[model samples]
Target: MPTIVVDVMPKAELLDPQGKAVAGALTRLGHEGFAAVRIGKRFELTVDAADEATLATVRQIAAEILSNSVIEDVVGIEVVE
Candidate 1:
């Protein structure tokens, strides 16, 4: 099986309320560790396709249906061999 990893993050221009709220709470929790922390969503994809072409198709599907290009970016794609 081939696994594809997907990540979605808020754009730099857009405001992230959830991230900001978490930052606020973290700061208040006495963990003033990092100056800033950006949070995003991650996923692991499982596919039975065994060819590169099919894998490409799956990637495209994930990009089109699983992600939004404007505000979020795909941060990683790791293929386990």
Candidate 2:
């Protein structure tokens, strides 16, 4: 079996309210030295097969249903086990 990692988040063009809120809280917490912060979502998946075809299908699933490409960006993906 192949394991997949999926991360999705708002694009640079859009506004990230959650991230902003966290950043504000950090400042109140006395954690300075930061200007901007962005938040994103992460998903871990286990695939039946570890092949290019299967991976492509997974990618499609991510693009169509898993994540909204228009307002999000995939920061990274890692296959574990």
Q: Which candidate is the best by lDDT?
A: 2
Note the clash tally of each candidate: 0, 0
Error of 2 at 15 (Å): 0.9
Cα lDDT computed for each candidate against the true fold: 0.74, 0.84
Candidate 1 deviant stretches above 4 angstroms: none
Tens digits of per-residue lDDT for model 2 on 11-67? 988989999999999999999898989998888888887678877877887787888
Cα RMSD to native, each candidate? 1.9, 1.4
Candidate 2 residue pairs that clash: none
Model 1 error, position 4 (Å): 1.4
Clash pairs of candidate 1? none
**The best candidate in terms of TM-score:** 2
- Give a tens-digit lDDT track for model 1, residues 1-81: 777677767776788888888888989998977576678887777768547886677678667877788777766656665
